[model samples]
Every structure is written in C-alpha cells, then in structure tokens.
Target: MIKKIKKLKKIRLHREGTDTLVYGFIVIAAIALLLWRFIDSKVPFWCFTAIMGTVYCIVINFFRCPIRFFPEEDTTGLVVAPADGRVVVIEEVDEDVYFHERRIMVSIFMSLFNVHANWFPVDGKVKTVAHHDGNFHKAWLPKASEENEHADVVITTPEGTDILCRQIAGAVARRIVTYAKQGEDCYIDEHLGFIKFGSRVDVYLPLGTEICIKMGQLTTGNGTIIAKLK
Candidate 1:
C-alpha cells in the first residue's frame, strides 16, 4: 500500500520546456500542409502527413518520463540502475577522475526510444559534481568515456564507499543534465537528472562489487538493481 502511494506520487510528466518543442512541431505540420496545398500541388499530401506523424510519435516517446517503484526493503548496499537502457559495457577500468584507481565500469546505452530519466543508484551524500567538455563521439565506443563530453557525480555511502556515475553525451546527444549537487543527500532510486536524447551512463563500482545485470540486459531506471556493494 505504501509502495503504491509512493509510486503514484513519483509519477510525473516529462520535464518542463519540452512542451514547446512538441507543440511547435505540431504547429509546423499544420502550417506546412496549408502552404503545400497552395504552393506545391505536385507533392502528395499523404506523404507529408505521414512523415510529420512519424516524427511526432518518435519525439513524444523520446521524452517519456514514467513513474518507477523503488525497493520496499532496505537498500543499504544495493545499487539500482540510474537510467533505462541496455547494459552495453562491463569491465574493469582505471578511473582517473575521482577514484583514480581500478574499478568496475558498468555502462548503459540509452537509445532514442528509451526513457532518459536518471536516478540515484544508492542512498548517499553527493561528494562531487564535475563537467568536462570534449568531442561528441559515438557513445558505444570505448574511447567515448574519456573523449566525449560528460558529467560526473560521485556519491559517498554511509560506509565511506564512493560510487561514481557519469553521464556521457553521444554524437546525437548534445546536452547532459545532472541534478546532483555536492554536499547534498541523495536517496536510492530518487530522480537525479535526465539526458535529452541517445546517450550513455557509466557507473564505476568498487572492486569486487557484485554486479547483477549482464551485458545486453535491459534495465529500468530506478527499478533494476545493478550491483551490491561490499
């Protein structure tokens, strides 16, 4: 009963400022048809309408923000997935920004059709937030972690375990939004931020952390448990 209420309270529409784009496209489609009827008689009306309809559908789904349910039990050491997507990369890598040591890197790749909302992986205090400007490379590439523009958010657990989550911009994704701030307390599965379009998020877990998801496995933001802390 309590979980249901919490889920209902968390249900929300996509972030503000996106309505303008949705309505703008609809308006443009209307004007386009009017102009086409008067100017371009050779162009088929059905073709234009179909193209516009397809674009509108895609745009609407891209900005979808669905309500998610957090775990009802204790989440002390559990790390939930921060975004909805497929696990693309999982390996050990040297993290230079915060950990400056070897850690397990679990990467989730968000496609245009996936929900881009991000959430906190665990209950902790925000330790640091940093942004880096770099080339917008394809997010799936291994080099994109360092070469692509990204933002890093590090949160320290009550036991002093620091987990790092990074938002990476892809070739098509130009903006990365991060709501986490240094010195703020964050709860597991709580809303952290969002990525506008196709992108990727990397979570650096401490060595020997038990990873639950496998590569290519689909994950739901705030609903899927990714790992368990030591």
Candidate 2:
C-alpha cells in the first residue's frame, strides 16, 4: 500500500523523463559545443554562455509545468472541476455526440503554468471515452473547447446519472492522455489523465446543477467543489 501511494505521487509529478531528456540534450549539446570551442580556440566565454542558456531553459520549463488529481471520495451527484484553472465559460451548450442534448458547459482554461492533470468528477463507471482530432487553438479562445483536439470521458455514477468531462488541447498543447475506458470502474478524484502543457477542460453537467464557481475563479483539481448534485 505504501508503495502504491508513492507510485501515485510519482505519476503526479509533471516533470518526468521526457522533460529531463529534453533538458539534458540541450544542456549536453551546449556543453559539448562550448568544450569544442574552448579546445580549438581557447574561448572559455562560449562555455559559460551555453551553460547559462541551458540552465535558464530547464528552470523555466520545470517551474511552469502543472500537475493535478481528483478527490478519492464518492462524488455521486456532485460535479467536480476536472482541471486546475480559471473558470472561463459557463453556458448551455449543445452536446449531441455524447449527452445527445443541450447541457450546461463549464469551461476551465489552464495556462502553461497551471496544473494540466485531469480528474474524474464523480465516482462511477466509465460509460464512454471518445477522442476527436481537431485544431489546436488558444486555450482561452471561445471556440477552443469545441474545435480543438480533445478527448471526452463520460462517467455514470451509482445513481445512473451521467457526467461528462473533456480534456481539450490548447495552442501550446499537442497531446491529451487518458486512462479511463468504457465500463471501467473509476472513483472520484482518480487521475484520469493529463494534458501536456497548456490546455482546457470542458465539463458538461446536467441542467439545474448549481454551479458554485464563477468566471475567473481559480480552482484546484480534485480539491475544488465545482457544483453540487441537484
């Protein structure tokens, strides 16, 4: 059990091997170039410049990456925010593909510095998981939620009520990772997946669910109460 907990925390760390590899490659290449220059021309200035530049890039990327997760308690009848970001939009939107009807849409915009992990909004069984190929637009752009490349995961709680959560790619985000699949048992606060860098998450709630958050409000994934079950 302790090992599992440690593994979970490790997964939540945003800077994995990919970030390390990228940073290492740039730093190593810069160092190598500087060494060659110093060996051939006795120019020590180039080495310092390369090392500083590489360090700066590594620091910026490491600090800006975001990681998040959801609560583990049963969230039946409650609507939890899926990502950490500012609430950008809340309106009635037609969602024909999954809900097959008009639903209340709550869109959260995640900046590059915000946590990019997505969480299950309710304790339930994964009813459907769909991925759509589309364009990558600015995350806060009005149409990005509907038009950008995204993946939708719908969960049906014990009461048989449906909750839809989507991870949408932003201008800076190129990939959406999801772990939930249809019929999979998922608990509230489970780490469903993550969005690389900046992105947005659109949560579709049943009409009449009281939205506790307003536009511009900052929320934490797995921690914030987005709305109460009606």
On lDDT, the leading prediction is 1
lDDT of 2 by residue, 1-230 (tens): 01112123323245433675567668767776767766766456566666666765654553343333443434446777777789999999888887798898899888866667777877778999999999998988878877899999988877878888989998888988898988888865567888886899988888888999998999887778888867
Which tens-of-lDDT digit does each residue in 26-108 have in candidate 1? 79677777867776674656667778778777877777777776845677788999999999999999998777899999999
Model 2 stretches astray by more than 4 angstroms? 1-12, 15-29, 32-74
Q: Relative to the unseen true structure, what is the C-alpha lDDT of residue 112 in candidate 2, on a scale of 0 to 100?
A: 68
TM-score of each: 0.91, 0.79
The superposed Cα distance between candidate 2 and the true structure at residue 218, in angstroms, equals: 0.3
| RMSD, candidate 2, Å | 4.4
User: Judged by TM-score, which candidate is best?
Assistant: 1
